[model samples]
Target: MRNIRIGDYLVEKQLITQEQLENALAVQRESKGTKKFGEVIVELGYLSEVKFAQALAGKLHVPYVDLSNFDIDGEAVRKVPETLAKKYTIIAINIKGKRLTVATDDPYNFNILEDVKVMTGMDTDPVFATRTAINKAIGKFYSMQNVDSVLEGVQAFSDMNNAEDDEESKDRVESAPIVKLATTIVENSYRADATDIHIEPFKTYTRIRIRVNGDLVELMNVANVVHNALTTRLKLISGMNIAEKRVPQDGRFTQVVDGTTLDVRVSS
Candidate 1:
């Protein structure tokens, strides 16, 4: 069978008009290789991301994965390193015998399949998923590792500086572990496509949760000592008044993740 082009397939299926395809093509050209044709169409509002991905999967004769409801296999996720998965925007979702099934937004990129196969020593099965879904899965799965060590580091840092004055504590908030904790929380939240990140203080510990797909999922809880430093780091980056904690404050910051700029709004 001859490989079907996404644009031609969409037009043949009446999903998009020829005029819209041409317009998207013009936009893609204007991007000067920065964007793919599918990306241009989605960005141009001609097709929803999921719709485009499904159409592309049908055209490519590959299975389409709805990652939002999919139960990811932890063993499969471990087959692909986080760095490799993030680099290629692909995630291993299942493993059967010598075959590894991975989901990617760009099923047309056979190079990703080959790279994964070589890295994992398995026959690769490529499936289609929306970029957002794959990104969210990557964050949700990969970020779950090493949590205990991270919290331990935070506790150690906080313990060592417990005797410091307020000014000194403020300076220590920029410590390596604290910085990593704050950065990880924000970056993970962004990659997970979370609408809100909740950091709540309780009597004993601080709870961290993120709202994804309209549901709140708890990420982790840390010592109350670590909470002050973590929130301080976040406030510093978001330009909030760290000293004035009694009043509600709002701030916004921009983060660039995997070449995409994300505007993050913070409330405290």
Candidate 2:
């Protein structure tokens, strides 16, 4: 954070391209040095604000705040004086005996947060957020009390209420056909108590098998169309490069089965 630039980090992480960075830099230059590189990239619709903040949090080792699901406390808002809040571009989100949780865009500005901890006589926990979200909190709790600045809070609240079913529905909607199929295959393997699920690609068909009790048991065979999609989906879930078939990669993820989370390892 002190020496490495954010753009290079994003590019190295495959979150953005070098071309996109150059274009954002051009936009920043054209702004007469007014806009920050991140602001330019976000304003140009190159990346979502939440994702940007998440990457920044990972790089800076700060906590990321998901504003869509945050519940603002009115008392917490008042703990930080309106003048200081606006001046430092921060908003208090929660407060305990002598510990205050605050959201701010600039986590590097430790002076402002130190002053806040001193003024309130409390320890401070910092969370990262987009500039806009902090402003919405300020508006909803401080200056513009009557403004409807929920930022999809109603929808998010409903999601929280029906979280389990809602999460499955949302995952289904976001997942491709092959992803869903891959999920089903893994679920079935879990139910069957299989040690390994194997998918082998052939010219015209694909063979699916499961290893149970040290024996490979035939599962099913699928046509070319299904096999291609299944292969791509498997690569995606395993965090492998689907574009490169010759490369060997390894990745692992956790899957919940019958209310229990299980680690599922994938390799190719």
Candidate 3:
């Protein structure tokens, strides 16, 4: 598949109103493909960026950005079997004598080769192309591994990260002030006695809408690009290949809140 922005893809496909297309396209051109379409639209004069981001975020099946300031690993990288890593893209910057290197589907990210070299204190190289191209290259590098299966496992973990099958709501909705996404959804569900929370994906973002009492209500919004990053991070955390996205995947987990153990299920 092409490493393309879906707003561009949707516009080319003629799948939306020109006004909508122009709004999205304007956002894309302004960002020059760096800032996400969701963010750009908000900056430009289009729909209320918040609502649009929320709807788009839900459609994209990703989480919203929160106000909390927690430590996040900035330089996060995974060590896959070089065999598996090389299966998807070509190692454009293969410094024969260095320990750390940068790999990206877009060779353009490699435009700053000198910067990377100076910052990391290691030789810097770049990989350019699509996930499919990288997968093919890695397959040639290591002929025995099943890249497809590895990808499936990764998607499975994405499901687990986003899933929610927690406790049953008892109908007495507690009116303690609103909290985070998880808390709001869980609390609303418990009070309304809902079964599942459905998250979906869109072109340039993901929406965090909730389903309670059999009705759907938009909750929070997040950029599609952010969601994409999160899904990749989740895959890496669950020991799955981050470069593969050809198939649907599922994963699940559990959390204890208020002395109650609840199951969370995620899928993509």
| Top candidate, metric lDDT | 1
Name the candidate that leads on TM-score. 1
Q: What is the alpha-carbon lDDT of model 2 when measured against the actual structure? A: 0.72
TM-score of decoy 2:
0.51
Candidate 3 global CA lDDT score: 0.44
Clashes of each: 0, 0, 38
Candidates 1 and 2 compared: the better one by TM-score is 1
Deviation from native of the Cα of residue 118 in model 2, angstroms = 3.0
Candidate 1, residue 146: the lDDT equals 56
Task: Write candidate 3's Cα lDDT for 76-140 as tens digits.
Answer: 12223453344334333233465444444433444355555554566654433334334433333
Encode model 2's per-residue lDDT on 1-268: one tens digit a residue.
Answer: 4567899989989989999999998889999988888888788898988788888888999998876478867788878888788888899998877789999999878897898988787888898998777765664456333212221332233333432231233343234454545665666566555899999877665777888788988765554445545556666666767667677888777776534577888888
Q: What digit string (tens of lDDT, one per residue) describes model 1 on residues 132-246?
A: 8888788778876756667788878867865323443655788988987887787778767788899998877889999999999998787776777787777888899989878
Q: Residue 260 deviation, candidate 2, in Å?
A: 45
